[model samples]
Target: MHSPGAIQPAELWRLFMRAMAVVDYARPLELLHVPAADIPAGHAWIRVLACGVCFSDVKIARGQMPFSSSLRLPHIPGHEICGEVLEAPGGFWFQKGDRVLVYNYWGCGRCPMCRIGQENLCLNLQGWVGFTNPGGFQEGLAVPPERLLPLPPGISPEQAAPIGCAIATAYRAVVTRAAVRPGELVGVIGVGGIGLHAVQIARAAGARVIAVDIDPRKLELARVFGAVAVLPEEAEETARRWGDGIGLDAVIETVGHVHTVDLAIRMIRRGGRLIGVGYRLGDMASIHTPRWVLEEITLMGSRYALRHEVEQAIRLVAEGLVRPVIDEVLPLESANEALERLERGQAIGRLVLQVGSFSGV
Candidate 1:
């Protein structure tokens, strides 16, 4: 077990850890000292190595998401976490110094959804890391042993960080919810961080993917990831032409705007599926009920991935099937700058924050 030099374990909880906090909505995160909390009986104290900056973090920071109102002030926001175990209780699968990727969701274990391995859909969620509780934007975190997933071989902490959210969420949308079939025509709207990953995942599933975005750069990146890129105006025409004049077999909408949802619904053929993987508070989409009934179109909402899906996503990365595209890496102190870049639509892929050094592992 790793110790804090000459200091003892009893003194660890008394020390302060450096962290970035959101003191107010629509404001920059401020650097502050956070008191370390005592580790519970079944929990472990982790030293954070890296955290991915998600657009959801941007929304939460700007108070644009529905959960923003419930968020406590001075909360640390970072869900995609990769870290090392500094201290863990006995009789657990992992020990101290082990590299781990956090699953983020802490569901009520007794709930019906959680009983069936669907913890992401738990009826009574206990806490979600970086959302309902303190997150990995700090030097250290207290996490339950069950929420920690083993970081497989051949992946760095920085690369593995986003697997907790972006890649896994895309995996759930494309593989689990949509069940994309080989030789199918798939349309992915809003080729941003998650959308780009969705494009790659669908292609890896043997489907022909068409990526739609307003930005030329994102579309170009999607093309590089093995998708036929198209603009918003050209999406419907391209989908019809590509799907042999019917429409796309499935549409994965990652932008929750009403306009994007409408576009996604319009791109689907008869009996096609529309998977909604993103959303904004108070935004609603209107569907034409007559056409919907006649076409038998299906609309589904995909939350985050299940635990096994996250493991599969890790395996995909470890085996070199899909690669997480990261735009830049910055020090933890540059979090505000990274969020600004994301807010301005300047990030092509994901931006990560390196919180601590990862060496000899």
Candidate 2:
């Protein structure tokens, strides 16, 4: 957050009590200040708790994946976060000190898609926190009140921050997209951040879990998270065997690698589902889909989570049914290092950014 260039704390703080911005290509991820901003009748200004450094953030920083051209420059990149209320605008269930998880995606409130409970696909999506607009990587996040999901008890702020994206995205992959069933066999590809959570959520739903990853360390951790079987990266036979020779009932692909997708598709049974949720780091590679189509294996793509899914994720964590593997919880000052490690695929699990918890961690 240190400014080596035209440092102007006075000017920035005048508009916001404190400002947080991560330079995408040519500026520093900065921290500044400003007088409070106006909260519309259905909105609130929230004090941030913690933010999960997403792979998308790294892509945005490296300019590997481009943002919308319409988006203004000097954009912030955090999209997974949990926080508390700084000020309320009334006419909502929220109150001061209410622990909440921010569903980063906000859409046109009254749109047909939103009315049907598909805000993630709203045509006029207003964008996410810290990406297309202001986000929770700062001391506070000002957003429409509707985007907030009140956190359940027994979940600390820092523990809940990564839940909105990582955990909820996994939930959607299993519960909604994959539609796993009790006593069914489910394969989760890439046992890193998202795959780790996906394994647990699938296991929680009464499925026998098989986790795949290139790293043995991640595979072992997946076992610890209730995975019944841990398969190596190239183990297509492992999946087929686990699927009882017919192929698996469901496979959640969190890795975008083409070879991995091919292996996962080969492991699905007739009428099985495959849920994919990863980005093209650089070159966009395609996976072969003839086997999937021939076998009637369903394929579903999941992105960000909606408010209720995030709420459900919080409850799961608070109840001890699921817990995030915080490989390293460092302060916001060390964000660049965290992002670098994440980009290298060296992180075992979610790398949480302790924004205001500097003194503790």
Candidate 3:
């Protein structure tokens, strides 16, 4: 590890590090030695230990997301990151060898949303870690100290990685956005990575969670996560039946497809809420305007998550209230294979990449 005060920013840039980069659109990531960017003032140099592979990473690699067109070439894309602090500026809360989970997005800090601690909903957006900024597919990262959340003692780097995205996003949707209460009938649409976590979070929040998915494997995993699993064809009916013939009190939509969004809307009872957590770039869902108006149904979109919510998720894992379902953990070199598996819908839960070996502190 380099001493914090010994190396200057320009000198840091002269060093090169290994990374997996997207050099062109719709192409495989190339393993290359790229110049290390300077760790800015007030930031820490994090040695990445693990990174969870999100479907958005796949979408970006395949040029499916709208923002893909604007990304600088050779972009490294793994946002759900876990790492250890290798170096830090003085007076910061974090120090060398401290385990941390990264919050992957940033905002203009002065925006109204940011002022209120909702940086994920910032008006003048800065960048996303894996989207607009260089991300954790590399061995090391330069991250702002405020974005680093300490990993609790019980969580390993691999176990804590997905908390940065999947778990944190689900916690925000179920607990914060939807405000799922005890005894409320909550339906989680699409039992994928984030959806499964939503099921666990809602259940932990004392709600009866009904999980809907087309894949039997995922439905079974949802059952293991404390939800009543059902097929998509049976979701609306199941929710209605469980809600005393009305519908669910809230529906958390993790599959942002048009049909799933439509199904989520239909599964909510009068005065209920539909929280959209998953999304594609241009996909649109049709809503019956009159029906929604008369029934008082609410449609809301949940982006990533708040910073404090990430810490809450870490606590949830620490207390064993929720477990992030990881289908497999592969080496960093297998990122392309991980992406291919996720794109094909073969993964039952979140897939993670072991960036570097780090025993828990």
Tens-digit per-residue lDDT, 260-323, candidate 1:
9999998999999999998988898989998788899999999988878999999989988889
Cα deviation at 191, candidate 1, in Å, is 0.9
lDDT (CA) per prediction? 0.89, 0.75, 0.88
- Mind giving the per-residue lDDT tens digits that candidate 3 earns over 1-361? 3455676674353266668889887579988888767678888888889999999999888878777777778789999999998877898889788999988887889989889887887898766898888898988899888889988677988899999999999999999999999999999998888988999999999999999988999989888878899998998889889999999999999989999998898888999999998888789887888888999999999988988999999999999999989999998889999999998999978999998766334
Model 2 scores worst on lDDT over the 10 consecutive residues at 1-10
For model 2, how does the per-residue alpha-carbon lDDT over 1-361 read when each residue is reduced to its tens digit?
Answer: 2232433553243244444455556545665553445555667766666888878777666666666445676566687777777567778888777767787888887899888989998888776677777665566667777788887677777678778888889988888888888999998888888889888888889999888877888988988888855555445677678777787888998888777777777777888887888757563545347755666767778877777787788778878888887788877667778778987889988898876532111
Assess every candidate by TM-score.
Answer: 0.95, 0.88, 0.94
Query: Each model's number of backbone clashes?
Result: 0, 11, 0
Error of 2 at 117 (Å): 2.5
Ranking by lDDT: 1, 3, 2
Residue 151 C-alpha lDDT in model 1? 86
Clashes of 2: 11
